[model samples]
Target: MRLAEIPLCVWRTRGQTFLFRGQNIRYWTAGQGEPLLLIHGFPTASWDWHYLWQPLAQRYCLIACDMLGFGDSAKPVKHHYSIVEQADLQQALLAHLQVRQPVHVLAHDYGDSVAQELLARHHEARAAIASCVFLNGGLFPERHRPVLIQKLLLSPLGWLVGRSFTRDDLVKHITQIYGPQTRPSESVLDDCWSLIDANHGTRIIHKLVGYLPERIAQRGRWVGAMQHGDVSLRFINGAFDPVSGHHMLERYLELIPNPDTVSLHGIGHYPHTEAPGQVLRHYLAFRQQLQPFKKIACS
Candidate 1:
């Protein structure tokens, strides 16, 4: 069934904020069951989950936040942004909420990297993540194919590029990542640009793009966590995504033992947005196969 869409304004209204390390982080939560955490990709926020929010919330308590520099959250121009810090933010949020049960993580793009770090913690018995499902992302640095804009953002001229970047430029770059047949609507693109433009977020694009290099430098830790972690794992990919599509899936199957995967033939980077129904169906099927967790006790 096609899920009803959650409008951006309503999404904003439903959200609440809490301070994290002197920055305001916006978050949204609903439903009640096993805890499920949703982490979005770079340049986007928790609103990325709006399409699947209600449908997934039907079966799991949902938690999603605009990480320190993205969405409606604070964007500190001088602060350093790293996947490790983002993972810590997620842990802090879970702790702040007093979530005692192991969480089921659904992460996309940049979020996939953050999930990898969290999974690394789980592998070391430092965190309680029950499972992780990755959408399109740079899971393996070698397999990731960043677009031209991303390359530019990483160059020495990156700060200047971020300063001069325009909404049209963002829309153009985002369009390149989706399947031709499933490209986002103008309105959808507008909402995405709105979130990025919030709190002068565009000014910090260069810093946030650091996750690309960070992924490469810490490849062993993150990738090893995926290969060795005992938690349930699944990869749901959109085949046409230029950045991390079929090729990345090939690498995943090569490295991850007993891999569980689902490939959306004509979809692209934003599977949850481009084809929410299929994503929902596949994700639900995967969750159904997992053993049930004990009810989470309230604080």
Candidate 2:
């Protein structure tokens, strides 16, 4: 179902607003017990977790927010959409919610890099991330393959392209990332386009795409998180994703020590959206394996 069709009552009851860095950050939380933070990837927001919300909330306190430049959050015309900054915003949100316990992180695409940063912070005793589950993300910069559109978005000439980017272009790039079998519906594309244009975000596509280089520059820190962090971690991949699909998985196994992976053969970049059941089953199993000794206290 499209985000717009999620029923007004659902949004009214679960939707929330928080203040972060002088911006109105939109967030949502539900269920209770251990805390679980959900982070979205590039070009999307918290709505990315709509499929896992209820099932996950039934077990843990699910916290998700639109990062500075996407979703319902304020999109500043000249802001640094750095992954470090995104990670900071998430920490701030947890603080604002009075969540003091360690949280399990579920991140996708661009969110994967943010999650790695958070994990690095936890390693240095700056934050608390009990575990992490990475889905179709560029965890290994050298192993990633950016599509032609992403390359242009990262180039100096991106400003010219961003200014002319249209709904059709958005759908094209987005649909291309998904496997052919699970292409997004027209309605879903419409909703995503609306979210992208929520605050003239389309005009700042170049700025938002800045995360690509930041990923490469901060490669040591992020990759180190997966390689050495004491926390439990797993990579759930959609093999069909051309961007960071099976190729990334190959690199992950090579670099990471005793890594864990769940590959969905036919799924694409958006396994959670395309194969929610499989994603949920794998996630539930991962959580169960890392089941905390006791409930995390949030006061």
Candidate 3:
């Protein structure tokens, strides 16, 4: 599909603010029930949620929005585009939606980092959250990113590369996302490249990458706290993922309440895209088996 052909409908419109580093914040809503928010990772947008949308939309109020520099959202030069900002913005978004009840968050890649900040705020504010369903990413900064690219992102050239990135750079970079054993099809690669070819294009990647400092600094705080049995977390992984890797979940298991993982064999970095049906099935199954807890409020 052409970049212009991408389908996006405004789920809900907000007054607009730069609360998250001066981003054009628009929280989209699609379908209904339980208010499940779906957050996507880097190099991709809400388009990542395409497959899981139809199936999961049946049971929950599906929510997915582009970060400041992604999808149909604004890609501003002045925005900080950091997780610190995104986390705060997300909380504000829920407040704007009047979502006082705990909501389920399905986050990936960069979204995972943002999710941590939101979770931390939840714990601090005594907010209600049913549970977090992990997918292909996590809070352990050391375990989350690959070294070489991490260096590039942290390097001086990051800004230049980010602002001047090309479609070829994305295709080349995404190649490493897959495991050594598995390869994504040309079409899959095309879809990813085409999406990035939209608004933010290459410039926002540097801004997105710049958030690594934010991730590393706040990495252990929330997940570490959760590791102490304060919160519930689970993992569902793409076995062939080269970026987040398979071993990171092991690092994750060392934390969390009763962390468990399911590896989708033959899948790559973007498992949701590589295997959507399987991803949805694993997610739904995990949702069903959340060890039902009582929701009665204490006076």
Candidate 4:
């Protein structure tokens, strides 16, 4: 979709706002079936799911939201953004929607960490995440290769980097993460920049980037969830993603037993955006295989 049409798409979704911890969070819901929660990556919003929204909604009740400091959500300047807090917001959204059914999670980048935390809660009989499908992300902090800009954003000079980073820089850095063959168009890149720049989001980016260190510190708890959690898990990776592509997949295979994975050759960090058809296909296939097990669990 072109940048010109992004607003139309957002309008069609008819996103609404919910009060979360005294902040208004932007969210969208559609269709009516088993609940499917979508968590987007860093520096982006729920709109990241725009590519697969309708298709996925056709099969499941879709729930997506912009966490604090992202997308159309409240961006409190001093609020500390952490994966655990984001997990709390996800749970709050489910409860607000009165979603009693076990939910399937589709997450990417920063969202992956939030999903991991949710999975950990599920292990503790706290959340009802039935399954999870991870896109490219720093699942293992050790294997995560942050780009130069990310490193800068996480450094002591991060505040300066956030203030000085421009749209061109965003396009440049984002382009580097995409596969060589499947780079995003200027319009898409523009939309990304606009989303990031909206409501002074760039200002709090340094604070949000805190997730990197938090990921490392809490790696044991989150990875333990994936390693031992009862919920079904799948990793659908874009093989060409520089940040967490093939190498990340290798780590997943090494650590996760009986792993279910799909590697899209030449695809990049944003698989759903870069190749929505392939992502939808694999995701649906994974869900289809879970039907029998889902029924048993629900019973």
Candidate 5:
């Protein structure tokens, strides 16, 4: 059976969906304690967290969701995909779930941008974010490396590229980003292809790629939050990732005040997926360092 069809040993069988902005948003909740929200990257959904889910759930009330246009969620072809909108959907999801206490955010790839926006809101006292752990991501737009395909899809000729995008193309591009030592298995590729194919999501790559430009425009606000020192921010990186690995870390050290980073020497872009155990250990340790905040009950 394909990994796409078979749940990981750690995956929970049950899932729930909520109506958000007239669309169905799929999510899963498990465990109990302080709420920890897992935000996944572009072209993937909450499934990216499966390896860490069952274990982390034992310690926190884990909530992972498929943001609009990804995974099993509604994929609207014409909708404008913005990091701020994604962040708003996340806030709305927490409100709908009635989780009033501040949440610990663990975000990767595109989700990291969403997390940055959330952290910015927290800085402005507009949201409840306790702590954040960012996996390999393009937090610094200046350090971002958009793969040729991403650049093509975001270009004026994006419609042609989107139309030509195929499962083989997806598998090839994704596999290239992993470390030489931790190449993704066929099953992993299958799962990704299945998710992207669901709801004809591949067709919306042009719309989804819009976040790249938005990231550039809002860099001052989002990156400012990371540098502001309002809430604790730690980055756990996979050093081998050609995209946002060591280069981005260098920028983080030069920019953010007192930045914290754990380098996984041989790992790549998807540390949580490529090396979950190590990522989890460093993540748990990072969480421990943040000064705990008293939980606020949502009336």
Candidate 6:
């Protein structure tokens, strides 16, 4: 299966439909039991969880979504997919999905950042997030991407990424993303390009790159989530991640309290997809470890 299932983005949810703040975004979900919401990062959508759905589905109600702009969700030009806005959208989406209890988030890349925003709003989220598995998108921007592309997208240089989508650039980046476990296939590159191309994917290059707005907005919330003791956090660090280098895990620990950090030897950024079997085995074992939170004395 693909890292994430892309076709879901194209299909709208049947029962759940609500306006988030204002933007109408669509998410795909399946299964039953406690709600498990999976959010994908940039350049990819809910497809990231394609391989994870089955194993996870057996345990909890699984809901994976294409965040507003990136996935096949509604893509309105100028829509600020910023953190605050996405937080509002996420609440509305959950409400529409009839999600009442706290949800466990399997977040990566921008998705993890979104989870950070959610934790800030609903303090209960800290306790309810059965676990958040990080796959190297650099949630802690200090050690993550932080600047560069964000500056470009926000500034004049933005036009460069916005207007350009060369076959080589797409291949190089996609290929590089899977350097550790296995090489990214051409189909994956095609799907990514399709997502970018599905809608003037190239034009939004700058706008999508501009996702820093969401990260910047969540900076404070990340700190808040760290201080708050409700959430259970763990890191599946990709040993070979260059961009994140050695900083992501440390920063993750800073905010996540006594986080359980695991090392995926020789893996790059996309651990879930790169070493699905390996990740799955470890994740299952991690889930079995028992831990209780006193902070979340049930109301």
> RMSDs, each prediction?
5.1, 5.2, 6.3, 4.5, 5.7, 5.4
Over 241-284, each residue of candidate 1 has an lDDT whose tens digit, in order, gives 98999899889888887788888888899999888998898888
The residue-by-residue lDDT of candidate 5 on 212-294, one tens digit each, is 98999999999889988878878888888988988998888888877777778888899887788788787787787674222
C-alpha local distance difference test of each model = 0.90, 0.84, 0.66, 0.86, 0.85, 0.64
Ranking of predictions according to lDDT: 1, 4, 5, 2, 3, 6
lDDT tens readout by residue for model 2, 163-261: 788889988788888877888888778777777788888778789888888999999988887788488888889999999988998888788877777
- Using lDDT as the measure, the top candidate is 1
Tell me the tens digit of each residue's lDDT in model 6 across 87-130. 56666677787777877777777777777777766674333454
| 34-146: candidate 4 lDDT, tens digit per residue | 99999999988888888788877788999999888887788888888888999999999999999998999999999999999999899888988889999999999999999
| Candidate 5 deviant stretches above 4 angstroms | 1-13, 291-299
Superposed Cα deviation of residue 184, candidate 6 (Å):
0.4
lDDT of 4 at 160: 94
Measured against the true structure, the TM-scores of the candidates, in listed sequence, are: 0.96, 0.93, 0.83, 0.93, 0.93, 0.83
Residue pairs clashing in model 3 are 18-22, 102-128, 227-256
Backbone clash count for every predicted candidate, in the order shown: 0, 0, 3, 0, 0, 12
**What ranges in model 1 sit over 4 Å off?**
291-299
| lDDT per residue (tens digit) for residues 1-299 in model 3 | 11122233322232133344444654466677897888888867777776677677789987667776775567776656678666666666777677777889888888888777767777776456667766787467777666365467567887776766666766677777775555666765666666666675566666677666777777667665556444555566776776675767567656555565667776667777666666677678668877522221110
**Which 10 consecutive residues of model 1 have the lowest summed lDDT?**
290-299
Q: Which candidate, 1 or 2, would have the higher lDDT against the true structure?
A: 1
lDDT score for residue 114 of model 4: 96
Clash pairs for candidate 5:
none
The candidate 2 region of ten consecutive residues with least summed lDDT is: 290-299
